[model samples]
Target: MNGAGTKRRIGIGIVGCGGIAQSHAAALKRLEQAGECTVVGCADLVEEKAKGLAEKFELPSWYADARRLIDRPDVEAITVCTNPPFHVPATLMAAERGKHTIVEKPMTMDLAEADRAIEATRKANVRFGVIFMRRFWPGAQRARKAIDDGKLGDRLILGDCILKWTRRQAYYRDPWRGTWAGENGAALVNQAVHALDMFLWLMAPAGQLETVYGKWANLTHPYIEAEDNAVAALRWANGALGVLSVSISTDPQLGARITVTGDKGATVSVTEHPEGRFGLNDVWTIPGEEEEMGRLYERELQEGREHFKPFPIAHFWQLQDFLAAIREGRDPLVTGEEGRRSIELIEAIRLSTESGAEVKLPLRTSTWVPPTRR
Candidate 1:
């Protein structure tokens, strides 16, 4: 027990010593200072990378094999930071060891894997979560509340998600970067998945998405095996319609935006300008609060600039929620099922793109394959 009360610091292990793991490590360090958790070890398939992350974070141990890290009795929980393909296996390993687990998003490559991971954790009786950190942003929460409070009106008529970000050729040079075998899909599944998740989250009140029609192309980066641009049209059960467009081929990197409009003629939107910065409520037209949009934007922008360094503080907030869930014996804010929703939506779009037909939702099966590019 590290804290003053009966509470104890949760023992944490980290799998995958990659760039994303650095953010988890930094957040864990802050949690450790608050007496919330202890980072006992880290692991990666490459021994040198494991050792490097261990030394950098001053964790107690490092291992080339993740199983060794998960088997440690002190590691009560672990964060699976591996790439999409490895996410399911790592989650299963942690669950088998009776350790609480949280995985980085897209959650798993597809619906089948996501289902397996969810079932494994449920059987093992361990808490599980997925990192969709943007949901922890205050602005996002405010937007959700506005919808729940019916401030956006009775019927959400239109929703749109636009992600125009840039990535260099060097980014695809990695063996796994632009491959169907490694990443499953490119712009839609890899980079724009975050925006897609945010889009789905904000539009949930509109009712379930009924169908999707999509198209994908490798236009700019012909050297890569995956598409660098994609677009989708969505229809909800409640009659709300949506458009989603994502691309990494843009020259200036315009970031992402998710906007929703209701029947009463009010609209609200969140924008992540320049991509990696925090999302702010850029457009708010809910009655008298119209004039407050500028103030709110500037205020949130300054807060994000101050707190986003050493990695986005959103990670810290979400990780804290995971740890609290572990101690309270409850599910995390972003549960495995919640995370699976985004993967399901992504898979629907991919299937529509492959068949050149509108895909009906609650996808009957996960047999859809990525479209082969020449």
Candidate 2:
């Protein structure tokens, strides 16, 4: 309905009013300024929270039920910023309403939910995209280019490295901060998803994941259903391997990073952190592929675009891309199936932790239990 005339601005609704919703609202405002979108309304179980964001963004309306927001006449696109549990229902709601979507990553808690949502989107013929912004970072771009350019040589292994980060006793005091039903899986699902997604994308592994071995503990913060610490091993389809190291118990907070190794060399990585009030900074470091990396970095620097690279780049890039798909009619860079694959891999890793065995990739779970918000 956005293309009513010539290049009409898109109408977007926000389906969650939590902390992440603020970012989506801000991003929507930026898109509005760029003449790409118009913020129509937002919804939250907490009515005041929805009203506050609506007032802050000067949105035309607000709702308590996400289904209501998705059903609005003016909203042609939607950003689902709810916690993990709400992803699938909200996704189906948007698709059923015929609106485009930009849902946040890890996509959902289980592979089953992801599968259903992705299939529904496919059936609806809508432009559904996920938020895997690390792939957009200047450094990530350089790394991807290096791999694509054969500078990194045949893909080898991607070491998924991340320091356990800042969730103190006080941080989990909210009650829902550290729980399984609330936050779902441990460090792997909540914290390292960004890195996991980046690793898979960069390595470009050919084979399905052969196995995963994992361990988890309340080693630090104990008030949660999920583990505060965890580690895993991944053997890729192409015989490439990955090491997953992360813990939520690392006090004082640290950044998440990844090192992708190829036939040629290694590429050090930096996960983008929130920068001031503007954006994020996800950086990449390819040890020897500096020439190509330098060219891309220098070009961005000259463009005076130190705006948020990586995550936020993917933010703007995907938003624009989804909008373009909505307008010109194209497929998104990261499709629903791609998003589902990440969930399936996550399920495999989680299964490894529970079953104490190597779970295969394209993890089949006829017994996969979907999340039901209690």
Which candidate number maximizes TM-score?
Answer: 1
**Per-prediction TM-score to the true structure, in the order listed:** 0.96, 0.85
lDDT of 1 by residue, 94-210 (tens): 898899999998787678788888999999999999999998988888888898888989878899999999988888766887788888878877888888888888899878889
Angstrom error at residue 346, model 2:
2.7
Q: Candidate 1: what lDDT?
A: 0.88
Best by lDDT: 1
Query: lDDT for every model?
Result: 0.88, 0.69
lDDT of 2 by residue, 1-374 (tens): 44465457889899889877877787778888888888889999889989999999888899888888888889998888887777778888888888788788768776667778878888898888887755666556665666677655566655565544666666565555656666676666766676677767766653566767776566766566666676778777777778877766664535566666676665545443321112112333455545665575456554424555323445676677778778876777777777766566667766676678877666654243323433
lDDT of 1 at 189: 76
RMSD of each: 2.0, 4.2
